[model samples]
Target chain A: MSGVSENRVLAGSPSTGEAARGGLIADVPRRALILLGLFAALLLVAPATVGDYLLSVMILVLYYAYLGLAWNVMMGFAGQFSLGHALYIGLGGYTAGALFVHYGLPPWFGMVVGAAVAAVMGGVIGALGFRFGVKGVYFALLTIAFAEFTRILFDHWGWVGASSGLYLPVEYRDTDDLWLLRGSATMFYYVILAMTAGAFILCHWLLQRRVGYYWQAIREDQEAAQTLGIDVFRYKMIAVMLSAAMTAIGGVFYAFYYNNLYPETIFSMHRSIELMLGVIIGGIGTLFGPILGAIVLTTLGEMLTGLTEDLGLDGIKQMSYGVALLVIIVYRPGGLWPWLRRRLGLEKPR
Target chain B: MPIDFLLNILVAGLLTGLVYGLMALGLSAIFGVMKVVNFAHGDMMVVAMYATYTLYTAAGLEPVAALPLVAAGLFVFGFALQRGLVNRFINATEHMQFLLLLGVAMVITNGTLMVFGPDARNVQLDYAFDSYNVGPLIVDKVRVIAAGVAGGTALLLAAFFRFTVTGKAIRACADNFTGAQVVGLHVNHLYAVTFGIGAACVGVAGTLLLLITDVHPHLSTDYTLLGFIIVILGGLGSLGGALLGGVLVGLSEALSGALIAPSLKSMFSFGLLILVLLLRPQGLLGKQA
Candidate 1:
């Protein structure tokens, strides 16, 4: 029962408080709704209250939360382990970035186009793997293979600037250009915040629906799900496609926010690892877990960076991060959200 | 362009493949026993390589002379890692196991970066520039010696598995986890020992690699994927398959680097992997799943 814990937890309380009943805000228990409402209000005013630097950090936190939420749809929900998620990020970013740079297409339109491309790529990979019944670690390797192949191809292709990297023309301004994704930090923060909140709601909605239940069933036992008349392949494909499409949206933001992209950095195994670290560290398959994880990890990571810089321990910085992660995983393999949920009174103490 | 030049490349590729096989041999052994692909396989090897490099530089000990000490040290490190950290995750989800090993790899890799300062270090032996004349082929002396040493180590590993009681116990555990446990085998201790042996094989391979390659922290990154590719290509748990897969991959690299662009060499390997995975997922010599 690798995922039985998640299934049990999600069944009792999918997102915030315990309630299998359907409907939005009204369906949530009084306490969770209040807490979520307060959290949302805080985020809405955060841009104005926080300094520019902290605002930027919050933007990153939201961005990572969005990425984690997107990734969780596939792995946490569907139990399909994709280790080469950077492939989708690269696909989304490059698709949008290339279209904008070369053809002068607006990023809003490019985002849609990027999502389609990413979905197609994810479909191809999922088909290759699922059709052959390549599950577990071997399936993970297949994802990496596709990602590495794409990276190599991009490195050699000069059309998208090749290994020299792709750069987007930026006109920094106070006024926001929503169409072009050109705006201030606050504007970007709101965009990512919207995406993260929307993704969380969408996941919660899905989890309580037929599709979500099917995904959980499939996750818990594929053979059992198949015997119970579930179209295992179709649901799995939906998970892959939906996750890929959402991840592409994050990639679109990454391209514009960073204003430059290198194939190596974009498709590197490092990107894939970091993208899932939030979900893994947070409660996998839980609604607020990715959000909590994104905040804790990004904040702590930033703190670690500053602390190391101040103490002249910069060299051992990553080593320290690695060691800390090990300790955390060893102590809380189920994730930090469950522990925090008890304190928050979201769930009864066992 | 010339035939002799082609022959030289072929010989060189085969020699390099032998070393690659040795590196993968260790990885395959670990997976054979534990069924957990040691994500830190390459970095653990890097630890041995760095130790070998230090021996050569600090005390003027030859890499060959210090091989035994370095291998033994890696064995202890691997055993301790399994017992202390990885053992907990043996029964955990695949994702947890992957994350745990990845954390270990990051620690080892970044720790090396911190200590080694990211400089690419190399060894300069007397015969570094020398090669042997074998008819139309001119093979590097260092490559030949390294290959011979690798082959010899592989044989020693075989004999260890075949003859030693501890080695036999480890093999039995791999064959049947519950069966071994039912027979009153110390499974945890045996698992640690298997991990240690895996690390030692990598230690042997890394020392030989230090003879031909420049040592660097980042070198560990490429080797992890490379080891996985070779291990998969050979056959999941088959030692002989790993060697054969290594040679094929090595030759592919050589041929592709010589004929096509060097950047595209990895592309060829991945392509071959996808093809094999589709056609025969069991690997070239792997038993039917």
Candidate 2:
């Protein structure tokens, strides 16, 4: 999406733009291959090199990156900003967790069910909102209201343990119960890494297709896209459903990894914001922006936590998030990707 | 429920509704002129609450007495906020405005948390607990007085918008940003003024709220969400609509809390919001989108 937009935006500088496009077209496959290689190498080598704590942090980074990618598919690619994406996460987590806990279904099956459930939920929201011509902030608010309603519903639904939260058994009997989702941090880390890599590849594939072009067109201008023979509504719905399904996978991972699901934490507005922060800071509408954003934010967050712990400041984490977002939005609204691309001389004309 | 009990609930709901209206008025006003939803509005209200709390705690002023000072303080804050941050993105996309205001909200809420240490603070007035019995209803003195102030302010705002030149200018901007610009309206100044007035409304609400509830950094989101509900229900930018919407929401909440579980009150309101969006997208009094 960013690629398409950047071409039009940077067209003002014909030379640089042309050069950048050329460079990008040449660089795309090579960059992808290199990134995959590096990721694989890191995946293989990191568990051995880093301590358990660091491994856990890496897992968190990957998890967030995956979620950010899912969110980016909707807001960045389709330009349908959903403020309550945590709805999908929560739905997925609860469904998978409940199945695992109550029905003795393995997370392997539960995860798929969770994803389907989230997709359906997303479909309902998108249908109701779009069918009624709700757009802009109204659409955003509707999403929020739905999320809040679900949160409240979950809060009272005792089957999910109500507000006390649904807890999954964390007793590790065997370290290699892959089907059951019982494993070491290393096992979970590897699984999450696969998922993150898969998500990135999926986004790349989608962005390369006709659907991706349609999404980008709709995002750039809905009316123009419709006039150009694009089914804006169907495309938007697909974007939402796909995004929700992907987010559900993350939620299932979270449920098993964290071994607990609370309506408050899972469905909180803060959770939605956290997922979006990565996409926003990294670069919306770009393939690797969410990954880059996840890394930077997680590293900064850890550093801030450590600094605050050392200084005995209780709420610096929240404060820092605000300051960072403000600085990014005000000074670098296009986010770090374009700037990073320029700095690295990777600004392709294609 | 018995008639008297229902009546009591109605009175209580109406009082709280008036407060909600005042809480939402500033946001409505700001949206009217700028068409931007100020996500930081709740945090601004928290700032007002803290300001009022400080006045009462440090200076021994009554919460009601501290109202003007808090209003003035918030007015300045809102003015500067619009001029410095919001003005830059005034013409930007709705998403940009949202992110900007969200950033502002985060800064204000977290900044307050850092400074105030997450402690809940409230001023204690002697008459806060005092109540008067009328027929079969009991009304707390603080709430009644707060309700009166809220009602009075709503009326004043209505008159201001109706008669005052500056208010009319703000209205003009709300009515048509481009047309107002063509007519030589100082859109920027009017935006700042509108935001200031909105902040002042929060100031008034904050003062009244502090009499009954504690001020905490975490509460800002709740206030912000509630304010959004009211604004949406009332129709964005309509003063009377805000009041009406607030009353309806407040009544719904109170009745639900009494008739159903206390936990479901918020859900009810949020559900109503979804219903409204689907059924009546323009809201009760809002112009057709």
Interface RMSD, candidates in the order listed: 2.2, 2.9
Q: What's model 1's lDDT at B125?
A: 90
User: Candidate 2, residues A1-350: lDDT per residue as tens digits?
Assistant: 12225422211232333334454333354554575578679777899899988999999999999999999999988989899999999999999999999999999898899999999999999999889988988898899998999999999999999999999997846557888989798899889999998998787666655687788889888999999999899999999999999999999999999999999889988899889988888888887788888998888888899877866666677677777788877888877766876676544445
lDDT of 1 by residue, A95-172 (tens): 999999999999889999999999999999999889998888888888888888899999998999899999999885
* C-alpha lDDT score of every prediction, in listed order: 0.85, 0.86
Q: Model 2: what is its DockQ?
A: 0.63
Give TM per candidate.
0.96, 0.95
Candidate 1, residues B206-277: lDDT per residue as tens digits? 998888889888778678888988988988888898888889998999999888998899999988887777
lDDT of 2 by residue, B1-289 (tens): 6999888888888898899899899999898878889998899989889988888888999988889889998899899999999999887788888888998898888888877877889887777789999978888888899899999998998899899998788888988989999999998999998999999999999888888789999888878888888888878877878898989998998999999988899999999899888888777998877
Clashing pairs in 1: none
Evaluated at residue A75, the lDDT of candidate 1 is: 87
Clashes of each: 0, 9
Residue A165 CA error for candidate 1 (Å)? 0.2
